[model samples]
Every structure is written in structure tokens, then in C-alpha cells.
Target: MTQSPSPTLPGSRAQTLASAESLVSAYEKAGYTRAHPGILQLAEPFLDLSGEDIRARMFLTSGRSGEELCLRPDFTIPVSRDYLTSEVAGRPHGYCYLGPVFRDRGALPGEFLQAGIESFGRSDKAAADAETLALGLEATAHFGMDTPDIRMGDVGLFVAMVRALDLAPAWKQRLIKDFSRKASLAQDLDRLSLATANGRPDYQGVLAALTGSDPKAAHALITDLLSIAGISAVGGRSIGEIADRFLEQSALDASATLPPYTRSLIERFFSISSDPLEASATMRSLAHDAGIVLTPTLDLFDARNAEIARRGIDLKRITFSSSFGRGMDYYTGFVFELRDGTGEEPLVAGGRYDDLLTRLGAPEPIPAVGFSVWIERLAGGAS
Candidate 1:
């Protein structure tokens, strides 16, 4: 028997092209210079510089020189890297791109088009945030999306809250790192609760193995012990990989956990959520209740929300979820996602990644914000 052909995607090829063109045009009219950095980017930066979210999904390949490479995952990083190395390194500029990106999408297509705008070196925080937010909404509307679910989050605010808390150093580091995943937060806190109640009985053992340690001797000892126990890399994973996992779990077992009160403070912070317009009051109330003083970061969030309103965006369309966080670690400030009720994922997603330029080898920090419009999701989000 012959297999059936795959069904056509939503919106015709022409409609998709038209929507993409409209998106690029909207960005260009808003001051972006059309830029196509092309496909085939170096894979190391995606591994070292980009967030872990995209690291595993990248379609990696090897070059003639045996250097690791990958098909462009997104225009944002390549475009930013280009900008950093160009003559316009530190100056203000807006870049727009529309191109195909490759990745492991599971059931979805591996190759799909993405159109985006990256505004770099903008000194005005509020303006840049507002512009990126507005541009995303406007582009969605331009594609006929009505009333997109404009959900917003602030990694900066989350970091500020973590910093404001009086927690054990280990707990703080763990919380900050795991904050991006909402589900993991609860699990980590639970582990902290149990671990704190019972001190790590193996702490001394870990200290002995990891400290004053010659790494080579440690490796030899570990291999010998594993070999003696008939333990080896199984399930298709390498022995090195198994050893690494063992070491990581051992470290976790050895880590000191937070006191109950510090864990309470973290749980309380995560519980805070409300409408975008009243986010300031909501956070302020949480602060007062917890007796923790949120820094000027809260004020910045409020100001950015106000500036977003000034850009004429309807606040009713936006919701602030304290638990929401983009998986991308480079987002140093405002983070948001715009979704259509019709789709499983956000149609337009972006945030301020101020430190990306520096990671790309730029001499100085470049304040940047941008959003990518998923061509495949525009019509779905619109409906």
C-alpha cells in the first residue's frame, strides 16, 4: 500500500508570502534596514552563546575543516553578531529579516520562515520595550490577527526579586537558574525543603572526591570504582556521560539547602500574578506583605507598562503572569509572548537581550530588543 501525501498547511503559499512581506514591510517602515545574513551559521555560538532552549534543537553539521556548524536557527543571533562585527558596532540601528530556519520541530516542519526586527543600542529603555511590544502586536494585526493573547513577563523583575530575597547562597543560585521553568521551581523548592531538614550525609564524601583533587586521579578512581561494581555506560550513553551525570547528581546531593523561611519567601513571590495594568500594585503589595523591598526594577516595570500604553496598545489585551518566563537565558529584561487562541504556541515572541552583543564579542554592552513573527502562526493567531 502507498502512503498518503501530507495535507497542505493553513494559508496558501501565496498568502504566507504576502503575510511575510507585510511583516518585513511593517518593520522596515518602522526604521529597520533590510538585512539577510544567510543560512549556515557557526554552531559553537548557538551552543555557547544562545540559550539552552535552542541548543538541543539545532540541526548541526560539520564543515570541510571539521568545524561544527548548524543551519540558522534564528536571525536574531546572526544579525546581532553581524552588527557587532560591522562598522555600526555600537551605534543605534533597527534590523529586519525574513528567512528560513532549521531545527528539530518533532511533528512540525523542520524548515519554516520567520520574520523579525531587532532594535539595537537604544538607550531609552521604555521606548525600546514599548516599540518592540507594539511592533509585534501591529505586525500580528497587519496579518489580520485580532485580539492576540499578549502575555508579558519580566526576567529582570524575577531576577530582582531573587536578589531582594534573603536566602542561603545555594538556594539563591538554584532558584535563579531554575526560575525559567515554572514546574521545576516547585520540584526544586520541594527538594530544598527536604534536603534542608536533613543535612547531606554524603557531603564529606563529595568534598573529598572533588576538592584538593587532581582531576586525573579522581577520574581514574571513579573509573576503577565503577568498573569494580560492574557499572558502565548503558542505554546508548557513553561512559563519560554516565560519569558526568553521577558527578552532577553527587554535587546536588552535596549542596546545602535553604531554611524553611527562605523557601516560603520564594513560594510567595511565585504566587504573585495579576493584570498588566495593576502589576505594580500587585508586586508592591507582595513586597509589603513579605517585608522585602523590591528595588527600582519594579518601578522600571511600571514605567515600561505605562510607556506601552502610551504607544496606544490596549492593556486589556495583555496579561502579566509572574510565572511566565522565556526559556532563552539571554533575555536580560522585559520578556513577552503573543499568542492566538487558535494556536498551540505564541505567534510572536521576543524580549530585551541586552547582553547578547557582549557575548558575541562586542567591546561594550548594546541595549537591544526585538521580536520574531512566526509566519505559520500569524493567521492562526489572528483567528
Candidate 2:
């Protein structure tokens, strides 16, 4: 059976386009140069960098040369790629874009207009973060969302908390990786707390044998086993990835559980939800009482809050949720979403993704942050 057509917002296409254009104009006035990246992009970058949530929704195709390609899912990666090849790559630059991005939205439209700005190479992280937030608010204001509900998070702070925990290296990596998935992260915490155990019962023997073995040796063994069984790959995963998974499983099996206090600390940290300033104080206090050093991350958080306050944005409008994440893995610090009233969907969303440039082939890390406006959502909600 053929699939049904995707649904559009309740408005004229022309009106939505106009709204997008106005948003882009606002970003340009704020010093972001207009960028128009091609619709088709190399698929590998998006597949690798955008995380599994996006990977599953991507509208993929193949180029004439058999190289995988896809419609631009979002402008951030494409825009970053364009900046990297420019003459001023690695230097501070800002870009704004407005265009259609493609993804599989089931009943919703698979293609829609998106407008936003990306700032790269900024060293003043706190100031840059504040600027991104301000620009996002301005975009919402353009649609009469003067006091939209703001939901904020900081992946950097989460990373700091995980790093300070007393746990095995593999466990720490697992927790950090699972942070974007609330259910998975909670399950991991349960496992760490000995409240539950997870593993494939069929692979119990193999996991046990591999446990405490040299990682390299285990990987090689798994690779050799897969070869012997004539299994070159499984579910699009490379043999190397499969091997790595086995190694990770073995590590997790060996570790089994964490210190009880560690789990309590993580639970407390994730439970924080308050205004930005209050959240910062609560985090600092939690760290101090737990004897873990989250001062650096907390200080940066305060600095960014101070910058936001200095710009005259009310702290009361921002709600900082310690467990909040954009579900995209690339966001390294300061993620946020702005919605009309308490709507479930955000009209605007973005975050800082510092390591994305380096992962996309930059010689070194470049600090980056930005947000995207959903033109259709804004137009639908506009008075």
C-alpha cells in the first residue's frame, strides 16, 4: 500500500515562507551572514554525528557513485561544513539559514521550513551562550511569543557529574552515552544500583568468559568468531562495532554494580529543576555535600546565567532541568527549547555543540552554538 501524504500546518505556504524570511532577517541583523547549503548532503556525517534518534528519521538516498546521501535533516551540520571550507575557517563566524529540512515524521509533514543561526569559533563561551539564547528568544518574539516557556539543560554539567562519580570507566561512558535517552539512562541507573540486571541470557557464557579479559583480545576473538560463522555484519553494524559491543557488554557484566552512594548522587543531580540561579546554587550545594567537585561546571553555568541576566532577560522565565536533553547527541552544553505556554512541542530549539566541527574534519575543536525556529509551528501559533 502507498503511504499517505504528510500533513501541513494550518496556514498558507506563502505566509510560512514570509515568517521564515522575517526570522532570517532578524538573525542577519544580529550579525549572522545568510547561508544556503545544498539540499543534498553526505549521509555519513549526519548518520555519525546526529545520534540514533535522528538517524532513524533521516530520508536517505544514494548518489550516482553509490556514496550514501540524504536530504539535509538540519542546517547545523551543513552550515558547519560550509564554514570549514571557507577561507576564514577556524576563525570566529556566524551564519543564519532559512530553508526546508527533510525527515520522516510519520503523520506529520516530512519536509518543513526551518530558520536559525550558528555561531562558531567563539572563545567567550558564556557570552556566546547568552547571545544564542537571546537570539532564540528574539526569534520567538518575532512570532509574538514574548514570554514563551523556556526549558533548559546543560550536557556539560551532566558529564561533570558522571565523571566525578566513583564508577568503572566503561560504566561512566555508558551513563554518559545514555543521558539523551531518559528510559535507558534510568535503566542504567537501576542496573548500577543492583535493582536490576540486564544481559542476553543466551550470551551469558560468552559474556562471562569475556569478562575481565583484555579488550583488544576480546574484540579480536569476537571478530574471529563472526568470521568463522560467516557473519560479516548484522543490522548495518560493522564487524568492528559488533566486536566493540561485545567488549562493552563484557565490561558491564564484570562491573555489575556501583557504590550505593554513587547512584544516590546521580539521582539527586538529575532531580534538580528550578530557575537557572536557584538550580546553580542547588547543584553547587549538592556537589559540596557529596564531596564531589562540580565547581567548574557550576561556575560556568553561573557565568552564563549572569550574562543572560545582564542582557535583561528575566531568570524566572527559564526553567533549568538537570535531566533535560535535546535527544541529539552532539549538544555538548546549554540546550534549550521554547514553547508557547506549556505546549508539548517547542517552536524553537537549539544548543551548543563544540566538538561537532572537529568531528566534521576541522583540524581542531571549535566552540559552536545555535538554535532553529520551526516556521510552521510559529505561524500556526501566531496571533
The lDDT for every candidate, in the order shown, is 0.78, 0.86
- Residues 1-383, candidate 1, lDDT per residue (tens digit)? 11112346544765776667766877788789888786988988888766666887999999999999899888888899888877887999989888778878787788877888899998898888998998888877888876788888888777877777766554566667777767777888788778789766655586536644565676667777778888777786666666655554555556657678777776666676677767778888877887777858888888898898898887777888877788776787788999877566888999999988888888788899998878867754222
Model 2 C-alpha lDDT per residue in residues 85-143, reported as the tens digit of each score? 99879999999988888988887889877888999999999999999999989988888
What TM-score does model 2 achieve against the real structure? 0.91
The count of residue-pair clashes in candidate 2 stands at 0
User: Runs in model 2 with CA error above 4 Å?
Assistant: 1-11, 195-217, 381-383
Kindly report which residue pairs in candidate 1 clash with one another: 145-382
Clashing residue pairs in candidate 2 are none
Global lDDT of model 1? 0.78
Best by lDDT: 2
User: Model 1 residue 238 lDDT?
Assistant: 61
